[model samples]
Target: MQNDYMIVKEGGHSIALENGVFYNPKMKGLRDISVAFLKAAGAGGTTLLDSTSATGIRGIRYSDSGVAGLTFLDISEKASENTKRNVKRNNLEGISRVFNKSIQEFAHTREKFDIIDLDPFGSPMPYMNDIMKLSKGGTIMMVTATDTAVLCGAHPKACIKSYDSRPLHNELCKEVGIRILMGYAIRIAAKFNFGVDVLMVLSDMHYMRIFYRIRAGAENAVASMKEGGFGTYCNSCGSFGYSKGIAPVFQQACSNCGKRLEAFGPLYLGRLYDKRITGKILENLEDGNARKIIEVINDELDIPFFYNIPKITKLRRVGSASPAGIMSALGNAGHRCSPTQFSHSSIKTAAGIKAVEKALRSAKDFRLRAR
Candidate 1:
């Protein structure tokens, strides 16, 4: 309404998306989470770069959240103009700079930002190297990848080509995709002598986003690289496990079902969240959807991956069991368990597949007796 392209309001601000300028309303929840994360991470008085700014919504919201300085970049001249207009509309012009250039061009400058966000249309891989040039010690990088198919095994060749890792195309693929993305980031950052410490991760609809802090040191980079490894999964029995290291000898067959095992990775085998930061994010969050997702992620176990309850039950020919009931069964048996944000029907636990199968059997028995 204001700029002839129709004004839309989100996150307490009005933004107009010019033709050819990308703005997704569905990502508002993710944006809300980003705002909460920035506030929780002490964004006040820090410089932020919206590396792929389109409609300038992200940068505007960040500025409103107390970011001291802001730089918006977009390759499309129209997109750049749109961002500048939005910045002016939001009264952020004084503290904001809009550049009609690609991140690769912007990297030519020696300026480094305290926070950098890369939310491109598809994969962020094409821009990662230049992003590293803009990062320094204690830099917080927020990356979003919508090429879920490539990272989730729908296109194994593409995944291998892009991430240099294999992916699983199963119920666990989403988490695998996140790990693959993280592993790729770790490798790329290490090349520049930067270590990555995952602060938070989310596998939401059609995309996966990661927040990580950069530590500057060759030793830290080496330590971070040690977290990369392969994940071995059994298609026959659905049992999976991972080993820490770039290369570790894995059994050729499923230890439980004796079927040939398939491996995916060179993926990250480290904790996915910083519990302290997650708690702080929860405290600052106000959006209902964002809060709900963050709550599940905050409580999620730091386990490598999760098991889809429905998949396990179907494989075992048992009646479908509720995730809560399964968690209860595992807890009663003295195993730590939690529902995963990755999938509503999945649970993460240190208990082996055999224990989960046992819990499924008990749930089926209980249901029959009740009936």
Candidate 2:
């Protein structure tokens, strides 16, 4: 009866979402990425703990994909039973175990996991410390945050309260959300005397997923905190800059227009992606959409914020310009530019707002001359 209600196939595993168990068909791409990342990370024969497994689809897929040991933990009884059923359905019992216990409790147990994945319904902040306590040096911790509204600065109070970091909602909201999550992770891990080595940062649909490897040390944590930076955004000029440190020395005026600027940070100013790991993940991708997603992230410039071409154009009262044309102009001007996978109308470039506006104006003049 449970199997007859609702069933979905993902990563070659059949998962049943009957009896009111939670399962989102939309997360298949996420599962695909997880599988690829795990494979790329050489997760074979490694122990994995899905601390907040919903229907156990992710952990089941991992176990089936050759993770040597798999454990599924969910506070909900229905989810636990569903996990057990799904594990049995996939014949993954040999390499998998289901626990109807809280992740908090599991964190205090003697069990150790090489990979600890925390994918919750919203912010993962509440469980960050517990997960860190359970993780050993060299452990890989995967975290997902779905509170985009908060992380993107739509709810600034909540963002600051939950993440202990400021967020910006603009052309760079996605990147800001990604970094806020990372910066929060770095700060929390540091509390446990752990340093985080980011392996990947992914933005998809309505959530941000981050992968980090934890290293044990007080000095490393201190160094990481010092390396993080805050974003200074000027709403009036569409210009921004990054300053490294936990507390930003706010700039009162926009460097380009002399208009006042707003600061958003103590967020992650470090690189969002590790090129080598991303390349390996790309090689391991079997799904077309997943491959496309990684390709976009792979091509994104390792800069602070991306410019929304249309937004900037509207602000400057300029005619519409091609993303490719703008990028080419900026490239010709000796500034690195690339179209971001985050938004079709956005471009990641080292060029300042004034420089970009100049590029757009130049493009417009060239067009008028051609006509």
Best by lDDT: 1
The alpha-carbon deviation from the true structure for residue 22 of candidate 2, after best TM-score superposition, in angstroms, is 0.8
TM-score attained by model 2 = 0.94
Task: State model 1's lDDT.
Answer: 0.90
- lDDT of model 1 at residue 107? 95
Q: Compute the lDDT for candidate 2.
A: 0.83
lDDT of 1 at 346: 92
Residue pairs with colliding backbones in model 1 are: 1-6, 1-7
Q: What's the true lDDT of residue 72 in model 1?
A: 95
Candidate 1 per-residue C-alpha lDDT over 1-371 given as tens digits, one digit per residue, 9 for 90 to 100: 44569789988899988887888889999998999899888899999999999999999988756989999999999999999999999999889999999999989996899999999989999999999999999999999999999999999999999999999999999999999999999999999999999999999889899999999999999999999999999887789988898668778888888888999999998999998888999887885888999999889998898889888777766677898988888888889999888899999998999888777766666322210
What TM-score would you give candidate 1 relative to the actual structure? Answer: 0.96
RMSD of 2: 2.8
The lDDT per prediction is 0.90, 0.83
Off by over 4 Å in 1: 1-3, 366-371
Point out the worst 10-residue segment of candidate 1 by lDDT.
Answer: 362-371
Candidate 2, residue 131: the lDDT equals 88
